[model samples]
Target: MWVDRADWNCCGEPFRIGSQVTWELRRDIDVRWLMEALGSDTAVSVDAFQYHHGDTDVASEQTSGTVARIRAVHWRSAPQTGTVPGSGVLTELNEADRGAPDRGDLTFEGFLVTLKQ
Candidate 1:
């Protein structure tokens, strides 16, 4: 689920594929709350960023590197109307995320994240 509430704030245009970066949560609340309210099902995108692809009982987008099973999430809300998680699971796992080749600290400007895919 992608956060899209009128009260909620979004950073900027979505990045492209192969762009490695880190992003922080905009709100303090869990996205599951919004997901349950909007989405009927959920699943994480295989991409490291977890780009939303809508609800599905079976995994969608079988293309290699495009389908990662995000444990047990079943989002039913539409991307244009769902809530995005505030956590940074994707960047945390990939130790070689943005930042430097050694340190993994990320820099942020408002909500913009810079990284290397």
Candidate 2:
């Protein structure tokens, strides 16, 4: 799942910014759907960045980009278990430079992306 500040058209109705959109990772390289959601038709770059130690401890660094800031929201399956699954979120974007958001009880790893015409 991903929450973005853009409209998405991959799953029938368009999901606007802040809407959680779910997408399956295919072979870990299929990102066409995500690019489309960001309203891009050309090439885009996606890079992975780590910003947290676990579900409780957090440490983030500042980053800038031309497209989107992809952050991973990680959480545990149960209260007694450790951190497990993760989802992505689209944060500050389009030439904006910012640091990772505060993840109080969840882990956030992120990516800095750029779009090309």
Candidate 3:
């Protein structure tokens, strides 16, 4: 679902929900911020500033073959009510949250990109 600005004009269909996407990193962003956005049910928007190299605008420099962008989408999940609404049956939760298997070893690689406005 990653569309460069140059290709955006050619796209006919609108972006839909639940579509996972990845794009370049236009500006510096914190990984925590991205994680928070993903966890939330609302859409978060941020502005992207055009970079400059010497007297030339880096964003318009497609000749260098380097353009930065970010990947993100608005996600919605069923509300967490702790149990089924009608039925009285309880739902099982993730084992990781219960400290079953210690898979806490997590690492994030690559730069955290943000969606450009």
- Candidate 1: tens digits of C-alpha lDDT, residues 40-99: 232221212222333445343321222121121122233574433432222222121122
Clashes of each: 16, 0, 1
Quick one: ranking by lDDT, best first? Answer: 2, 1, 3
- lDDT by residue (1-117, candidate 2, tens digit) is 232222121122322224443332111244454453333322144332222222333333333223323332223233543324232234543332233454564433323333221
Best by TM-score: 2
CA lDDT of each prediction against the hidden true structure: 0.27, 0.32, 0.26
Q: Which model, 2 or 3, shows the larger TM-score? A: 2
Q: Candidate 2: where are CA atoms >4 Å away?
A: 1-83, 86-88, 92-98
Q: Distance (Å) between predicted and true CA of 42, model 2?
A: 17
Error of 3 at 45 (Å): 4.6
TM-scores for all candidates: the values are 0.23, 0.26, 0.19
lDDT of 1 at 28: 24
Candidate 3 has an lDDT of: 0.26
Model 3 lDDT tens row, 1-117: 123222332331233223233322233322333344333221133322223233333333222222233332222222574222222111122111111121223221112123222
Per-residue error for 43 in candidate 1, Å, reads 8.1
Clashing pairs in 2: none
